[model samples]
Target: MEFKNGKITKGFAFLDTYELTVLMKAKKTSKAMKNTMEETQGYLGMWVTEDGYIRHELLPNNRYDEDRGKRESAYQGRYKVTGNHIEYIDDTGFTADGDFVDEKTLHHGGYIFHKKLE
Candidate 1:
C-alpha cells in the first residue's frame, strides 16, 4: 500500500488467520513475536506505536451475520513493505477484553483484513 500526506493509497493486505498464528510462534525474538500479535489487532482499528515502530490498522471483517458482535474494536501489528506484497506480524496476542475465540472450530481461527486508506 502507498501512504502519502498521511493518507493510504494502495490499501492493505489481509493475511490468513491460521497462517498468522503459526508465524507468531516462529519469531526468533520473543519481543518481536509479542509485538507482531499486538500489531495484528491494532491494525484492525487504528495504528499502534510500540518500541518506536509505526503500524497501520487493517480493515475488519464485515460479514454481518457471522461477525456482527464478534469483531474486534482494534487490531495490532505493523506492515513491512516488501516489493509489492506487505508482510504482517501480530506484535502481541490479543489485548485485554479483545474478542479472540478459541481455535477449536474452523471459524474460530483469527483472520486478517486489509484496505487502502486513501
Candidate 2:
C-alpha cells in the first residue's frame, strides 16, 4: 500500500504475500512515520490491534484545565482490524497506573484502518 496526497493506494504485488512485513517496513520509513505523526496528532491518538481482540497502545494524551481547576482527563483506546475497517474504541479511561478510573464503559469508536492480509 502507498499513501500519497491523502490517498491510500493498495495492491502492491510485493505486499501480496508479505503484507505485514511490507506494512511494517513502510511504517518504519521516515515518510510513513511523519505521516503517522501528522495524522495521529490531527486526532486524539491512534491504536492498532491484532486478531480483532488484542489491544496495543500507540499514543496517549491528557487533557488539563487551568480555569475551572478540574482534574486531568485522559484519552485512550484500542483498535481492532475487522473486515475492511479497523474498528476503534476510545475514551476508555486508561490511566497511568494501568487502571480505568472512569465508570463509563469506556468503549467508543476511534479511527479506522483497512486490514491487509497476506
Candidate 3:
C-alpha cells in the first residue's frame, strides 16, 4: 500500500494482512526558483557540457543500417573531441578514433551522433 498526493491511494490484503503507508512530500519550488530551472534546456543533450561524456547507440535508426556490426559492443566508454578528431577510450582499455563531420554530426566508434530532437 502507498499514499499518493498526501492521501491513501491503494491497498491489497491476504489471509493475515498488515499494511502501512508513509506520506512524504518535498517542498514546492518557489516561482523564482522555478524560473531559474527553465534557463537551461537540460534535456536536449549533454553536448552542452564541455567535459566529455559517451553517448552510445545500439540499433540504427535510418543512417546506420550499414554499420550493424559496428553497433555491436560488449563495452563502451567516454569520449573527447579535439579539432575534427574524436577519440574513444573504451572501458576495456582500447583507444579508437573517428571524425566529426559537422557541428551536429559525429562519426565515432563506427556509430553516428546527431543533435537529437524531441
lDDT of each: 0.37, 0.35, 0.43
Q: What range of 10 consecutive residues in model 1 has the weakest lDDT sum?
A: 100-109
1-118: candidate 3 lDDT, tens digit per residue: 8899998899876642232222111223353334321132221232211222334432211111111233444455655545556556666678777665554565666556664443
The TM-score that candidate 1 achieves is 0.22
**Local distance difference test, candidate 3:** 0.43
lDDT, candidate 2, 1-118, per-residue tens: 7888879865465436578878878778956544432243332232222333423333333331111113222344454332222334555543222211122112223322222222
Across 1-118, the per-residue lDDT of candidate 1 in tens digits comes to 8999998878878989998888777764675534433354432343222321323344454111112233543344444332223344444533222222211111112333332234
- Listed in order, each prediction's TM-score against the native is 0.22, 0.18, 0.34
Which candidate number would show the highest TM-score if scored against the true structure?
A: 3
* Cα displacement (Å) at residue 42, model 3: 13
Residue 115 of model 3: what lDDT? 45
Ten contiguous residues minimizing lDDT sum, candidate 3: 58-67
Ranking by TM-score: 3, 1, 2
What's model 2's lDDT at 76? 41
